[model samples]
Target: MKSLAELAEIRERMKSKVVLREGGNEIRVVVGMATCGIAAGARPVLNAFVEGVNRESLTDKVTVTQTGCIGICQYEPVVEVFQAGKEKVTYVEMTAEKAEKVLQEHIKGGRVVEEYTITHAKKA
Candidate 1:
């Protein structure tokens, strides 16, 4: 059981994350979290993005969220990045490590990690 002060600290931290999600002008990082995705390990992928975004102080520029089936069970654990002026990029078969790379290269550096993308998956 946490003391009131501890609980308040937890709430403050969570409020910051919630605020990040409420932004209207930030790049969106959507992770597929449907049953298939979870079975394939999407949870850690989602966490990686959220943590990385916060750690990098990119909360003002990025929003990480989850969604249901992306219509491709084989591509469970898919992540889609949407920026205002850029075409959406769909990354397939993602892991936590891959999420970090995507956050750095795609979200932060404006360069997609092509090897993790759907096109790359199809080619492999």
Candidate 2:
């Protein structure tokens, strides 16, 4: 705030934490953040994805972003993963802990965490 150089420094630091949607990433992880989603705890789920991606050094491959209502209110706190040339996978009833597992098993390992997926929720 004191000088132009200091402002630039702050901007650079924050740019690392901000996920831009300009597109080049191999995968996109979107979190639903509608009113219902927030009530069901989407914020932490979103943060978890962001932090997990950086921690795993997959930021170049994955982009984590938030969007309003994903349609299924019952599935509040929902997360959707989109990979190029692949079907989108939706994960429901998410928690921060679940986010990490999804990061490791799904994002890094190239496998879907089916138990947390919408199809599994329907069966349950």
State which candidate has the highest lDDT. Answer: 2
TM-score of 2: 0.84
TM-score of each: 0.85, 0.84
Q: Tell me model 2's lDDT, rounded to 2 decimals.
A: 0.92
Model 2 spans with C-alpha error above 4 angstroms: 1-7, 10-23
**How big is the positional error of residue 53 in model 1, measured in Å on the Cα after superposition?**
0.5
lDDT of 2 by residue, 24-88 (tens): 69999999999999999999999999999988888778989989996899987899999999999
lDDT of 1: 0.91
Give the clashing residue pairs of candidate 2, or none: none
Colliding pairs, model 1 = none
